[model samples]
Target: MKDGEGHISIYIELMDTSSLPTGWTVTALVNLFVFDQIRDKYYTVPAQYSFTTDYSLVRFSAVKLEWGITSFVELEVFNDSSNGYLVGDDCVFGADVFLIKQPINKVNVLWMKLYPKGNGKVAGNNISAYLCLDNLTLPSDTNIFVKFSIGVRNVVKSTIIKSTSTGKHHFDYLSPSVGRLHIYPNGNKMKDGEGHISIYIELMDTSSLPIGWTVTALVNLFVFDQIRGKYFTVPDYSAVRFSAVNLEWGITRFVELKVFNDSSNGYLVGDECVFGAEVFIIKQPINKVNVLSLSGEGANHLTRTHIWKIRSFSSLSLDFYESVKFTCGDFKWWIKLYPKGNGEGKGNSISAFLHLDECNLPSDTKVFVKFSIGVQNVVRSDIINSRAEHHFEDLSLGRGFRKLISLNKFEDLKNEILVDDVCIIQADVSIVGIVTTK
Candidate 1:
């Protein structure tokens, strides 16, 4: 009620039943001095947009929804976590934090298969990644590395991306999480498609060159080899312009960053965002990228010791081995023991089946084991039994030592239980089967 300004407020204490309107209507009833007779609650809501809130909110307008400014939205998003997430689809831990910086969430659909069209668009045949909701943006002239996780088959070159836009700033980053960008929405060169991701990056800002700039990012469908072979170079790229821009480090203001899947197979995009280029405030330049180490390295055996003790079973150590430190080529290392359940370690007592596990091992690989051999049980004092056990490699289908001489007995003899005997059989790899002798 202000001085005669028709701007008076109406107070309607409508208890909102916090539920989305599926098929609900609003009925309003009020009485006034102008009305002659007492009126019933009049309900007039034909087609209203449904909205529900989980907090205090006041309606400033009944129809056009003038929700009194509060730190809350009158809506709830029940997202199916299975079918990936869209842009702006976030999980806020503290209720309200989107005011400072743009909050981000990532959803990935790995190993998506697709067939590319030779005409230029990357076919969404096995379209693994989709930004459903309001389409996500892939910046223009953005020199980013977008990698797909494809396997030893499937042509990423013939692939293209098809998506609706959010009207503005709709760019795509296939494998780019780092560097320089020049391609814009209207540019038409770096639009989201298949065969290869094409974009440009900014190298020179103002008059100074980017001294600390280098492109580095982990991409999907791209292995170390594929990256080495393709994408790293955009043909004849010199400046950020129409078709393909040349990308060398400091020569041009804009450079094109390209990525192509050498082995058209399925690959999972790892969720670690690397920079298009890491800029350092340096006077001159720094170092080149780090050199690669051991290629396709198998396991480097750590504690290669055999089990030789009370025979019934020796508890395997679980503390020392949390994860497998060595690689097992084609076969897995399954360190077994006797008495079925004696490997059960308890506290410090050797009783638990302590082990490290690996799931992504290659097929047809096996592990050889060695034992801790000490003097006491056998005819030779310098040696316990046999360094004497025999073993051979086999091309069998299953894992473990192809040809091995396992102790084959939980207790070889009654007195063989070594209450007084002191011995330790040392071997190379952890034997799959526990070998014991009297």
Candidate 2:
């Protein structure tokens, strides 16, 4: 710091604390100058300050003195200051220290737009924005986390609309390389009844930040102006800046201005408008987070057949028998044959049945299956067919006909029904529907 009779000089320097926690960096943007009390003028340095290292230095010399005899020197440091510091009659020196460096974790503004929702029977409308980041490295062996909210404010109104709503839509990113987020303001409060609105996006978070660095984020917002037929930003409010340590940052409050939807307001073009946003993330640290991989197999269709040739037809061991088992539609089934026939057709006809694997179908659930079973006449090339179609719940599991074919017809040698003292049988199975009862 230097002072003289008719002028003043200010010198600024930075020092890096190597002991600072991870993700934390040290730097400052300093504007050193002499405010003229009498001339009402500011004599500032010729160029902006740039601090890239711990030993960086900036000097402002010979700034013409203010108030003639009594003057004061002002120093200001900030990450962003697009809005002039002169508010009303007071001089404001605002500072935003971005301490975090993101080399791997990249944050960006994906998209923003205004959508209209009708009133009355229709729902209210709103304006929404999306935020995304790629390659976010979460610390391993520790549950390190961060939380923040996005916000929107109308340039035409004087109220700040925080984008943090419980109903705000959020998506869990399954990809290991990227994270996506979105938020929308209540439409009813945003759009003019005629369908025109102006809004901007902001970020806010009070969650813990990584060690060693301060985090600073810059987001740019724009609105389509109907009168000018181009995108325009409200002066001094086009960019939102956030500066914080892990878990120590807060949202910057904003005021809204009311712009009517009518032509006189000059914001809407036939009840439509467009909006957009962009974000800048800065940070430094080497860490990693896990990304999950998901996959599944598709459904399949299959068909199978089983055959049983019965020998010694005159000396059968039992009245009824079943063929070898086959599988289809994830279940086991078989064709059953009763050479002597059953029920009303006893000793006169051959019976055939289709049986389902009892253990495969859950007893607590209802299952529907369709199948056909039959015995083939070897020489005649004709089929003794039996069809079964029913709901096989916990009760019934099998379907068949007592008299699938007459004994005389099955035994006839001219038709070759009993060829070479051997009989052949086959069956077809398919699952059509399955439902679990409550």
Candidate 3:
């Protein structure tokens, strides 16, 4: 009940449950409480009762409530243990409630594949492919603006080919492009019946841009020369319109290109290579959109060491297995060790590997980590090391150096890899980057 003076009364009803099991009876003391949204806390109401019997109407009055703001309420009940009614393995019930409703936003993900439609050979530069988005669902009248790229996988590690605004370039390595290639979702310049992909880019509303300034996008493409390890610029650099109005309805466009072989220009790697690309908002006058980095970008590296004192290592009847668990870059990891070499190195060397504990990680996530598995010299200060960088996705959980150390060399006291009965292993882990995709 609300009065004209801005004060209202709230009521809660306790339904009668006399129809419960023949001998069942609820006998508990209950309390009432209210929540203050503005204060982020709960205030107990001055109401307590011994609910031996249920009633239809329980009313509360003189509650000071905000006129237009949101609020919450809660109800609590306690069992009076001293009373014989709530004993002998009886259960108590309570409830938690909220007043206002919040809105939710959903995200969509798109996957695509590329297929070569020409002669199935990239040699001599006649190779072309139809890169299409296989499955996508969008609301009617919705537009999408997107930037697409195609390049070799792990380019940073190989450095065989470089992609830039200017085009593809060959650095210190004379990247022999087995052939140059282009990616096209839908294009009239080249005929590819293989597949089709709906391409779109998403741009944030500029009306809310920092200080309300507008920005546009300039798009370009770079094709890769596989063998030569270089990139050739594809024609057609176009500027697209971007505005606050288009925030809801973006630009919808398609891409397709033709690749010409440039072996004469020293651009040919081989018949096969992996490629990737990035499409994003213009980053010139805007100074790039703000991003929060949880860990240092590039190479945020850390190391961990473990020593295993195996008094019986020399007398072991069979191969010995051991492992250690540690944390690096906010991720749980483990070191798997084998005293007797595994696989081809069995009985000849020691094997070690790094494994990721998938317990706390999200499904289908990508984790990039670089690390080294090494044996620490126990007698002298030396480390036998094996270093590698890898991309660990949902499917890849562990990687390692199989033949880390030779057993004969390990037993040699002069080598110092092992002293007395203790063996030392070290893992230097560097988390370069992490990406969570929806």
Candidate 4:
């Protein structure tokens, strides 16, 4: 440190740390030039700093200039969910500091609709469920996450068929058949509504539920983030940056920062700069805590089945070979994954082998890489009356991604979630010839 100089240069980068944006390299050196305007002198401060390594895999690091540490600013690190903690109000000594990160959590698929129960009175749909969340407790106002999932609560198998015809057919007038309607005389069945879903809720996630602690049901709501330009609010399970709710399962309404030009309750669009939203969930104080993964298989997991011709109930591994295939000029891939062992065992989350219909591929065309998984061959089983929704989402198709249509949503809205094994996907390879790129 030098104090006798008549000039000083301000710099925050150091050579030994790591390479950064710019000035993240080099050394401290400036040329001093002197000119005579009657004893006038000029000096140039060419400050240089260098890093000890690369910054490609780091968030940030800092070294304190030891000066009794009375007044100093330190580099802070936090989860990416913080996008920017939308710091507006504060009463702090670190109290205002919030950390965020990407979110991870499980969701149970459930479909519900408003329908009439007994007495012909309109009522809320009975939601069958077996849902739970890990790390549902909040450590501070900063960490929270919400997972979006539906549970098939109280669903009963249905028995109804419309002579779904195919194969050899007969035209009574000329022997030109129009498919067969071989229905099982005894296989037709249906079950009525079970009841409203009510999964057990416990405060402390442990080997056993705590004595009296309870996790009262909670939910969070959202309007829109004009700054982010997205209106949809997706619940995030983990604090990881990816989840829409920033994993704030805290069950609090989202809030962005802005100066009030009018009453807050009356704030309108284009009112303020949205740094980020905040979600919250407070927990009752407890001494020791242990976070456990859901006891059985992951949440919202679907049951699969096989056998194409049988309109079976929810069964495991329903064979869909006849419905899946490739078409000329089309580039797509499908994947399926099922528990390696018992349906309730825990193991690595890996995908099943991808099978392609090479015969239909327009010769020499390649398949685009994608992120997808499914139940290979699912048919209705005697146990589970219906199959779980096969989850798939498209990532810009040219790269081989298929668009995901929340099939679960459609089923609930259409009141068709209780049907037996149904094909959730139908890739029309015949239309490959018309796809165009922008």
Q: What are the lDDT figures for the candidates, one per model? A: 0.26, 0.44, 0.43, 0.25
lDDT of the structure predicted as candidate 3: 0.43
> Cα RMSD for candidate 1?
27.8
* Candidate 4 Cα errors over 4 Å, as ranges: 1-98, 101-127, 130-208, 212-220, 223-438
* Candidate 2 lDDT over residue span 327-388, tens digit each: 77666777777878877678898777777778877545655566677777776786667776
Highest TM-score scorer: 3
A best-first ranking of the candidates according to their lDDT comes to: 2, 3, 1, 4
User: Between prediction 1 and prediction 3, which has the larger lDDT?
Assistant: 3
Q: Model 4: C-alpha RMSD to truth?
A: 34.8
Off by over 4 Å in 3: 1-311, 317-320, 413-415
- Write the number of the candidate with greater TM-score, choosing between 3 and 4: 3
What would the TM-scores of all predictions be?
Answer: 0.20, 0.31, 0.34, 0.16
Tens digits of per-residue lDDT, candidate 1, 131-176, equal: 1111134333332212322233336776533321111111123222
**Given candidate 2, what's the lDDT at residue 353?**
73
